[model samples]
Target: MTTTCLVVMGVSGSGKSTVARELADRLGWQMAEADEFHPEANIAKMRAGTPLTDDDREPWLRKLRDWITEHDEHGEDTVVACSALKRRYRDLLRESTARVRFVHLSGTGQVIGDRLAERSDHFMPPGLLGSQFDALEPLADDEDGTAVDVSGTPEQITDTALRALGLQEDAR
Candidate 1:
């Protein structure tokens, strides 16, 4: 059977980590946060309020793709929380061997910025929220993914994503 990788994606502060963790726990899949794949330099840049250029993201995206492929080789389904803001970035991720899909956690910039302002543990700053939204390209019709609104509670959003993605019944 082909392994599946659900990439919970969106601009930063869109609750990607919260929703991805819920999905992974409910589905009994291994989970990873995209921040974990970033090199120290990337993290530092974001922390310093500089948006990452595509060149800075290329190697990081490749690392994520490789991670998916490695787990797929082991027949393990996975979930990842990532700020896959651009269509090209998503396209690169789809190059993995796993049947990659996305769940876009989407909301207005105000909402996400509010959440980011309250977050204290992440490396990304609230000031960078604008840059994230500026770069985000919503899921295209041709993409194998669904977009979930972030207006609701985390559980509500996760439920919506599962239903939209046709994975509700598979939840544990």
Candidate 2:
């Protein structure tokens, strides 16, 4: 059987972690946060209020792709929270994967900026929200995913994503 993986993606502060965690828990799937895969240098760069270039992101994306490969080889369903803001990035993730899908957590800059401002512990400063929005590319028609508006609670958003992805809720 092919392992199925879902990348819960969006710009910073779009509730990617919250929704991804909830969805993963509800589905009984392993959850991975993209930030955890970043090298210290990348974290430091973001902490310095500089947006990461594609060159900077290549290694990080490769690490994520490796995670997908690992889980697929083990036949485990996994959900990952990542800021896959570009089509090429998503394409890179999909390459040679078993069954990968994306769920885009999308919302307006104002909403995401407000959330970022309210966060005190994250490395991504609210000042960088604009760059994230500027670089965001909506999921293309050929992409195997759907975009969910983050106007609702995390649980609600997770439920919507589950329905959209045709995943069944955990019975327990």
Candidate 3:
């Protein structure tokens, strides 16, 4: 198989990490958490209840792009969970690698807030959810991606994404 990568993207509290982790395990691919690539400054901003500006996020996005390129050159199948909330962010990813496709997780702000509150530990607070929605530019319908509803169980969500990406169980 060619080196392909799937970007599992969504706003905070949308289960991006959980779904992406399971998907990577099932697909036997290298999993990259976009959060891990964030510079300490960005993490501090979120922790302080301040949403990151586009300028603040640009470097982080570049890091993700560079990682994708490096891993692609190594012929590894990869999955990344990123809050690529804008068209421009997605464009940067496209420019970095030709093998990337996105799976966007979407859910109601209330649902996301509940999830965030229930979670034990995460930098992003529920207070940032409104800001996230304010800045979010949902993936366009014509975009080459899968839009999965995240209102159900994480397992069900992962199965949908796996089927959408054609990731098979045996690959794990």
Candidate 4:
């Protein structure tokens, strides 16, 4: 069987982690949180309400890419949660040897902002939600991915993504 790597992507508060975790569990794939790849400095900068520059994100992105590659080499299906906000960042992820696909979790800023405001444990400050939205570019037509609106619960979003990606049957 071919291995697949699903990148659950969106801005802060778009339910990337929640949906990705559910998807990975359903699919019996390894799951990773992109934030775990961030260096202390990057996390500190974001915690300070500073938007990360491309330079600051390069190493972090590379680490995620390496994880994808590692899983691919093991012929493992994997799911990862990441704020692949920009097209370039997504492109870097697609460089992995595995069959890389993305699920873009999309929601209105107000919706996401409300979520951010309610969450207390995350390192990403609620104020950075605006910057995240600004940086986000929707998945283009040519991209190997689908965009699922975040208007539903996490389970609904995960089901939508699986159906959109033609993985619903596989998950069952």
Candidate 5:
């Protein structure tokens, strides 16, 4: 059977995790958090309010890609929260055997920054939000994905994603 992987992607504080979790629960699909794939050095850099270079993110992205491929091999549909800020990174992820599509959580800097300022549980510092936006390359028309505004509640965002990705009927 064919499987589909939904990659919930965006800059930091864009609500990727929240939306992805809701989508995964509603769709009853396997889920993974991209941050879990980060190396300790990457986590430490972010905790220090330092932005990671492409080199620092390569291994992390590869791990995520591998995760997708592994799930695909098992014919399990999946949802993952990843900050695939660059087209190149998304390209690597698209190599999966599963139909890997993206759901980009988009929001203005002011909005996301405000949300980030209120968070204290994550290793990523609010100060790095700017760097995430700077590195982001919005999905091109050719890419199999849709961009959803992150200004809404998590449920609302997930609803939009389900409809946009044609997965509404799969919602449980």
Candidate 6:
């Protein structure tokens, strides 16, 4: 079956966007960075080192849900980079479609924090990485997705994800 949605998920600095962008390019899929969906208030809160509450994330999650449906119905494969820090947040995406697959980009706090430190332009502060981990629920092996370590280069991580998702040769 054609995979319609891919959630390149993880906490801050997990390289979700880097991997997801590469996967989407290979699959000819549209890419949506869930960060782009966050309202200014949420961004501001994170910038201030304040963790967001569930209510703060609801609108962002809903936007992702809508995008999943919008892209899937149009036969447009889409990859979304989202922290999806909790199971319930992922469930929101699941509500949109059964074809939604998740790719968990994972790394240790030090690794991710280091990566986030060198990153620029993003509103999510490195300070939020700890809080992100506090909210994460790693996917199980039986789950409908892949989990890849972000310790390698973006190419390596993306390759692992694509291969696991059976889109390895879609790079053509």
Question: Which residue pairs in model 3 clash with each other?
Answer: none
Total backbone collisions, model 2 = 0
* Ten residues in sequence with the least summed lDDT for candidate 1: 127-136
Query: Of the pair 3 and 6, which is ahead by TM-score?
Result: 6
Query: Worst 10-residue stretch by lDDT in candidate 4?
Result: 1-10
Per-residue CA lDDT of model 6 for 82-172, tens digit only, reads 9887888888888885388899988899898988899898888888888789889998666679889888999899888888989787775
Query: Taking the tens digit of each residue's C-alpha lDDT, what string does model 4 give over 28-89?
Result: 99999999999999999999999999999988999999999999999999999999989999
TM-score head-to-head 5 vs 6, winner: 5
lDDT by residue for model 3 over 75-102, one digit each (tens)? Answer: 8878899989999998888776548888
Tens-digit lDDT track of model 2 for 89-168: 99888873668899999999889888988999899999999999899999999999999999999988988888888785
Worst 10 residues of 6 by lDDT: 1-10
Taken over the whole model, the C-alpha lDDT of each candidate is: 0.93, 0.90, 0.86, 0.93, 0.93, 0.86
Candidate 2's C-alpha runs over 4 A off are 169-172
Report the lDDT tens digits of candidate 5 across residue range 106-171: 999999999999998999998888889889999999999999998888999999988998999999
Give Cα distance to truth, residue 31, candidate 4, Å. 0.5
Error of 6 at 28 (Å): 0.7
Where model 4 places Cα greater than 4 Å from the true spot, the runs are none
Q: Candidate 5 — worst ten consecutive residues by lDDT sum?
A: 11-20
**Largest lDDT belongs to which candidate?**
1
